[model samples]
Target: MNNKKIFAFVIFISLVVASILLLGKDMFSPYVSFEYAQAHPDKYVQVIGRLGNNVPANTEGKGYTFTMTGESDEQMAAWTAEAKPANFEHAEELVVIGKFSREKNIFVADKVLTKCPSKYKKENN
Candidate 1:
């Protein structure tokens, strides 16, 4: 092939490689499971799970430590995390960004969001 053809091919391959590298990072991103969180307490993880039941109400004070149950029994694991205030305690879903702590047996979520069922409400109606 001519110099121009070879140059273009190299450029195309470079672009493809760069794109793949960028997208591939997401694939390597750590998935936070209850078991995983327990296994690796220090490594930062992106955890996702259901926000079942309030922290027994009258837990007392702000940001009481709590647990997040995974989706299934197999995935079922618990971690101690400083949850938000009482009003926000009733959150239906939680996505915690933190590391696991085996001794603590808690996720230690740095951030949490309550799933707003209102968002799923039918808008067309």
Candidate 2:
């Protein structure tokens, strides 16, 4: 191939690789256990689990904090700056996405999603 053609091909390949690497695990499956998240405090990860018995309470700042029980039965502290999610108290399953903060010893949540049970949905008799 000519120099121009070869250069274009290389650029195309480089762009493709960069996109894949830069996107992070979010493009694939980002869900992980609490243990893995704690191990990689600098990386953002998603953890899906049930709410522990403790209720979420306001932080000294503006966010709310609580404990979540991972599917593996591992527990971790989670804090979210957003207002306590609707139905948070009754959520059967919840997913928290954020990076663990070793300084604060908590998972600083960027997003919180709650999955309510079928009771919240309308039933057809």
Candidate 3:
């Protein structure tokens, strides 16, 4: 009777709180500089930089390794387990999501996103 109703209300409130907590977690990590990532290797972060001149050889269907220059002109090696993006070479900007590997001294990227140069071109009137 009254006890049963009280138990049901408590259970419903618990479920609502749990759902909010689970959904509140950040979907995308905040962008961090190369220096900060190097210092905090354990935490996952996103790095935004421009593709550097040196491009590591991409083996048969293997991941690609390349250097990226941060906004502060700091260079860091980034490795992605996934295949290189189609517009990687021509990308003006790159956003790498992953954590830094202290042992390897490189950023192990979970995902790579590219912003092509043409995307910023102004249309001729």
Tell me each candidate's TM-score.
Answer: 0.55, 0.73, 0.76
Against the reference, the lDDT scores of all candidates come to 0.61, 0.85, 0.85
lDDT of 1 by residue, 68-116 (tens): 5677833333333365544455566666666666665555556655564
lDDT of 3: 0.85
Ranking by TM-score: 3, 2, 1
State the RMSD for candidate 2: 3.5
Which lDDT tens digits does candidate 2 get at residues 1-125?
89999999999999999888888556454789998888999887888888887655556578889999987777898898988877888889989988899998899988899998876677879
Badly placed stretches (over 4 Å) of model 3 are 1-26, 54-61, 123-125
User: Considering summed lDDT, which 10 consecutive residues are worst modelled in model 2?
Assistant: 53-62
Poorly placed runs, candidate 1 (over 4 Å) = 1-31, 54-62, 74-87, 123-125
TM-score, predicted candidate 3 vs. hidden true structure: 0.76
In model 2, which regions exceed 4 Å deviation? Answer: 1-21, 24-29, 120-125
What local lDDT score does residue 41 receive in model 1, on the 0 to 100 scale? Answer: 70
Tens digit per residue, CA lDDT, model 3, 53-82: 666535445687889998878899988879
Q: What are the clashing pairs of model 2?
A: none
